[model samples]
Target chain A: MSILKIDGVSKRYANHTALDNVSFSIPAGCIFGLLGPNGAGKTSLIRIITQITGADEGEIYFRGERLKPDHIKEMGYLPEERGLYKKMKVGEQLLYLAQLKGLSKAEATARIKTWIDRFEIREWLGKNIEDLSKGMQQKVQFIATVLHEPSLIILDEPFSGFDPINANLIKDEILRLRDNGATIIFSTHRMESVEELCDHISLINRSKKVLDGPVREIKDAYKTDTFQIIGNGHLMITSPDFEVLEQHENHGVFRANVRILNQAKPNDLLRYLIDRVEVHSFVELVPSINDIFIRKVKETHHA
Target chain B: MRKIWLIIQREYLTRVRKKSFIIMTLLTPLLLAAFMILPGLLMTMSGDEETVMVLDESGLFEGKLEDKKDLKFVPIAGSLEQAKTLYQETDYTALLYIPKISIEDPKGITVYGKKNTSLQTQMRLENALEKEIENQRFMASGLDRETLDKIEANVKLNTINLSSEGEKDNNAMITSAAGVVAAIIIYFFIFLYGVQIMRGVIEEKTNRIVEVIISSVKPFQLMMGKIIGIAAVGLTQFLLWIVLSFVAVTAVSAAFGIDAAPTPMEQLEAGRVAAEGKSVDVINEEKGEATQAEADEFANTIQDVTQSFANLPLLLILGCFLFYFLGGYLLYGSLFGAIGAAVDNETDTQQFMMPITIPLVISFIMSYSVVLKNPDGPVAFWMSIIPFTSPIVMMVRVPFGVPAWELLLSMALLVLGFIFTTWLAARIYRVGILMYGKKINYKELSKWLFYRV
Candidate 1:
């Protein structure tokens, strides 16, 4: 079942339409990717879902009910441009944010304590956020995002500033939260992370959703039946069954990317490559989300 | 409501816990008391005694100039030239060189000093010479000194206002002074707390913490929480200042043996007894002992002041003061908050600030010049009723006794104005806080105000 169903939400600013007939649904207990480039109405839509703003022309359903202020208690949002009160102590800031999300003081404190210990940041409890490093502050930001154990947590570029290790740490926590029956809407244009983490995504471009599906399904749909073949022999044969998209020759060997057209399959392409060049390794080249994003955005831009 | 309370708690505690707030709260009253007491003490304290060497070149008079408490005179036995030549050798403050001139045409009467003598010394010398000449003239005309003295008359005009309270004694000078002072205080507090709200908004926006906050609470709640929180801070400071200032003034005035207000409570009782014997004041003004009459007049002034204070509708005035103070701040505070939200930083707020500041300054000036001049005038009537100017202008009229209907109308409009401005500001604020790096002007701000956020 979908935890959030956004139906034809449209938002207009003073001069421009921010979201135009945008519709998407976030499946329950899944990491949903809200993928869009800068000024692509992602923030605008997120703001609507968070109830920071209202849609000009649409209805939003949270858990099959119309979205209302009370639903904000189940929702937690960490904006891309997020920060904490610099002069406020880390522990107090966490408790304040948790309470703001409708947790009682005692509940928030206990949850904050667990998170602080889990993150091994007990020493930072009484210290002001300004005294912490950027990574530490981001961790605190993440902790604040889920302190109330919100059902639908929205993280915008949650790993933007973290090092690889910290990013993995947060990525693991995100997966763990999903494992524990919490839905997370991860908004980012960083397609590699979307590939690494997002199960489902809706691509918004120019205030319109140009793409939507599960990551694997979208990748499969955008598949060009391309295959990368690396071989020791360099003589390539051109045939109607297969086309060598590109080939680069090295010392006594050639690496080629080929696409099969017509009714040909990857097995056929592998057999064809085995006849033309001594095929050492044959692998199907699945479209990366990056290439799909760029191509999709470019197609819309040109249109 | 709970969310707003949390926001308010955060805003208030963060500010109240600041070192600057603590220091300012503790120090402002003492500093104000010091400013009040310092100049008076400086002026009243006597300076070193200085004896002047007199060179009567005109020979019209000698030893006629009387000595004051801090000034003395010595008749030097020498020509004016000799005295001037011997000036450096004498331990005198100045040389009063009265050159030979006609008594009828007295000019070039100079007092020369190493450093020029004080104005008091010069005035004393002029009085002495004028008296000596006047006495001479009186002697020549065969007029008695007593009759001349009796010929000088003094008049005091007393104003009595017929109000609903019946025959309330109104001192125009004192009442207007009090009114203007209260107006100034209202103006001061509104700006002080209004800027605090603005800065607080700017801080949250610049820190990029506003979005995080508003996600959990409505923008209106956040705005009001901040505005109300800072108001509480201002009220806390203001109340502390009043109490501390009263204590400081009383202690310092007592230490210096000066009567700050002369126990209005005690004198209120004394005033009733003194009222039965009003003839003595008139008799003294006519021909009683100069010192006795002066003392009596001084005592009457103190009693008159306390009496005026007693007659004033202080409870009503103070209640209105609080209403106007909070109303004015809220009305302007929302605008200040909007301005803060519209800009990326404080430096970019000049254009937006003009609207709020201009009205505030205009009302303050009007209260001082227009409202104080004629509290019941048409200009005062309109200004007192208008929400933008009412807080200050009405305060100026309050002491001069505003009509109850006008007071109610002004207060009602102010509350409505506060509501309207807050609504307008919230619209602008909800959009502006999320906007960054945009070079915003009034056109941009108006656009923000209409955004359906």
Candidate 2:
């Protein structure tokens, strides 16, 4: 079942239409990547689901029921532009945010202490946000976002400012939260994280959804029916069944891309390559989400 | 409701705990207390009387010099050198040497002092000599002191206001002062606390926490919570000031056995008793007698204040003051909050501030300049009725005896105006707080106002 289902969602500003009749659903217990380039209505759609804004024309359902303000307690959002009260202490800010999300003071305090200990940021609890480093502040903000243990979490550009180590830490946390039965809507233009983390994604472009499906399904749909073969020497193939798309000879090593035509099979190509040169490896070339994102956006641009 | 309450609590607690708040709350009372005792302290600066030895070579003015307040003259029948030695031996402030010169061309009078004498003492000595010489010349010209004293005419104008009740003593000075004071306080508080609301909005917006906050609670909730919180803070500070000042003054007065000075309102009764039908005592209002009753006048001044206050409608003015204080803050606080949401920083607040503050500024300027001068005129009447200006203009007009119907109408309209501005501000605030880096203008604001939220 979908954790969030948005139907016929449309949002328009004075100068432009931010989201144009966008329709998608985020299934329960899955990591859903909300993919789009900058200004492609990704934030607008997330805002609608979070109820930070209202859809001009749409219906939204949460947990098989219509979405309402009470559902806010069941959701956690970390916006693209991360911020905390600069003058407020880390512990106070966390508890305040937790309470705002409908947690009681004692409950918020307990959850905050747990998160602070888990993040190893207990030393920063008493310090003002302005006194902490950017990375440390991000840590506290992350704790604030998830302290209520919300079932559905929305993080926009969650790793934008993270260093490699901290990004990995957040990446691990995101996966862990999803495995713990929290449906995650990870919004970003960074396609690599999507490829690694998302099981399903809906790509938006120019205020419209250009692509939507499971990550592997979308990748399979964009495949070019090509295979990359790495062997000892360059193969000079003259067969009409298998077309040599490209071949490069690097220091007596042969790397070639070949597309199988009709009346040919992958096993047959493997047999032919083995007969010709010593076979090292043969794998079908699947498109990356990054390539799919660029191609879809460009296609929409041109259309 | 709970969320809004939480927000208010946070806002109030954070501000009340600030160092500046605590410091200001404590310092103002002490300052007021110090000011109350400032005159007494000045008197005690040289508590003992200082003696001045006069070496009179001009035997014509032998033993005529008299003692002044805090100044005594001792005539020494000796040379200037002996008088200088006398001044050095004793703690005499100064020694005056008058040469044998005619009254027509009096000169060569020198004051010798062990130390530089105070300006007050020197002025008093000079005045006494001038007066004595004038008297001697007048007597020589065949005019006695009694006749000259009678020739001095004194005019003490007492303004009596006639009303339907009857003719009564009216102190224009006291009433006008009350009006100006009320206008100034309203003007000052609106700006002081209005900017606080604005800066708080800007802070949340700039810090980017506004987004998180609005997500959890409605924008209107946050705005109201902040406005109410800051108002509470302002009230807390004011209440603390009043309570602390009252307690401190009462304690000091009890300890020192000194009566507190009269408030402006209380001075009206003193005006009535001290000024009305007192022409028989006009002859004693001379320079010499004026200097003698220094302490008596202070007590009399306090009495005048107490009576003047008794004459005015104290309960009505105070009740109206409290109402307008809160009403004015609410009215301007919401608008200031809206401006804070619209702009990214304080520098961008100028354009929006102009329209919101213009009426307040105009009312403040006219409340004293025009309304006080002509309290019953059309300008004062209209200004007092319009809610935007009424907080100050009505306050200025109230002490000058506003009609009951007009007061009620102005108050009712003020309530409606505050409600309307708050609703308008909430609309703009909900949308503007979410916008980032957008150059918001009046047109954009109007658009946000109409957006179907």
Candidate 3:
């Protein structure tokens, strides 16, 4: 069953439509990627779901019940414009925020201690938040947001500031949390991350959902029948069943790029290349998620 | 309720724990003491060793000034022109020129001196000439020296009563002192804490921390908690100030061989007698030959001033102060909170802040002159009863011994005012905290006040 369902949500700001008839759903306990380039309605949809901004058009449901103000307690949102009180101590600030999210002091402290130790920022407990590095502050904010153990987490560009190592750490943690039955709406333009983490993906363009489905399915639907044939030397093959799109020689080996005709299998193209020369390998070059995302956005713009 | 308490506790603990608050709490009394007593201390420390040359041309008389240990009188044997030259030649403190005084014109006496000459020097010279003429007349008359001495010791007939309970409550001085104290407390709390709320709001708004905080709590709750927390801190600091000031004044006076605290009866007697058209100078004198019976009568007529402080309708003063302080703060604090929420930055707050701050300033100014004159009169009564000015004007009136009905009325009105203002402010707060990019104006704020949640 879907955990969250947004139906016909629309948000207008003066002359501009922030989100136009945006609708999507998140399956229970899966990482759902909401991907779009800058100025897309990803943020608007996220805000509407979190109830930070009201939708102009339709209704949202959490666990089949209509979303209400108090339902926010069950969801964790880490907003894009990150901030913490500069003068407050890191530990105090985290505990306060955690308690606000409905955790008791002892529970918050215990959870905070575990996270702080995990982040190895135990010495930073007594220091003011302003004194911490930006990356460290972001980590603290992340810990505070998730410490209450909300069932659903909404993270907008959560890895924007972290270094490679920290990014992988957060990515791993996100996957672990999802594995532990927490459904997360991961919003970002980083398709590489979407490719790795998301089970289902939705791409928004210009305040509308342009394409959405299972990550592998969408990629497969947009795939072109292109393949590269590797052989001993450069060989030209002309057949009605297959077309040698290009040929290039690298060092002593020759590579032939080809596209199959309608209903022609890769084995047929491989057989055609084998008769012409010694064929080493035949590999189909499926488009990556990034290529598909860019192609879809461009197509939508042109259309 | 728990969230509100959490917010309030955080605000109070965080601010009160700051080094600035602790330092300010310690510094206020020392600064006040210095302001009040610095001039007197400086004067005494100067060791009065200045020489002055006197050229009394209008000297309706001469040799009338008594010599004192601090000042040496030098009667220069030279003309006005020669005295000017002598004055320039010597490092005289000042050259006094007492213009001629005609018997037909007693007010025509004038004294001139260099710019550097102190007013004390001029006053001393004038007293000398005036006394010499009086002494000459007394001697010329057939009056004996003993009779003249008795006449010189004569004092004005003054009666004083400290209690306001009597129908002929004659002690205006005690009332005046009460008015001053009341006005001061009102002035101190209103602005001291009102600005604190404004600045606190501005700080959170500017830092954009309000975004994170507002997400968890309602804007109204946040604002109420902040204002109340700061007020609690202000009250704590004020209580400390009163105690520390008392301790410090007592300690310093004790160290300097002075009576630190005046007896209640002594102060009341002084205030009451001063109210009855008597010079306090008479009370200051250590010795006088007034008859014991007359002295006893003089002392008995005046009620003690300590009765004013002690018998000060305790519940009344407390009720008035608390109501005025809380009401005034909440009423103004709501506006400040609205301003803080409406504006994206401090600079933007200035536009909205002026209108809210003006009434407070006016209340402060009114409490000083008009309110102090007659706390129960039409002007004071109306101003104190009004919501915006009541916090200050009412507190000012309390010291002057306000009637119970008026005090109760003012407190009720102030509380009602806070309720109305808080309701209005919360509406604006809801819209403003989330608003960004656009500059807010009074018209927009008014519109926000009427907007449905």
Q: Which ten residues in a row have the lowest lDDT in candidate 3 chain B?
A: B284-293
lDDT of 1 by residue, A11-121 (tens): 998789999999989899988999888889999999999999999999999999999999998988999897889999998899988888889999899999899898999
State which docking tier applies to candidate 3.
Answer: acceptable
Taking the candidates in order, what DockQ does each have? 0.66, 0.57, 0.34
Mark the regions of model 2 whose C-alpha exceeds 4 Å error after superposition: A297-303, B34-40, B46-48, B56-69, B88-90, B97-117, B126-169, B246-298
Is candidate 1 or 2 superior in lDDT?
1
Off by over 4 Å in 3: A228-232, A235-237, A241-258, A277-284, A288-303, B36-192, B259-314, B366-386, B396-413, B442-453
Query: After best superposition, candidate 2 residue A43: deviation in angstroms?
Result: 0.7
Q: Rank the candidates by TM-score, best first.
A: 2, 1, 3
Lowest summed-lDDT stretch of 10 residues in model 1 chain A? A268-277
* Share of reference contacts found in each model: 0.80, 0.59, 0.22
lDDT of 3 by residue, A223-253 (tens): 7888987779658666787777788888868
| Candidate 3 positional error at A222, Å | 2.8
Model 1 per-residue lDDT tens digits across residues B351-446: 888888998899888887777878899999998899998999998899888878999999999999999999999999999999999999778777
Better of 2 and 3 by TM-score: 2
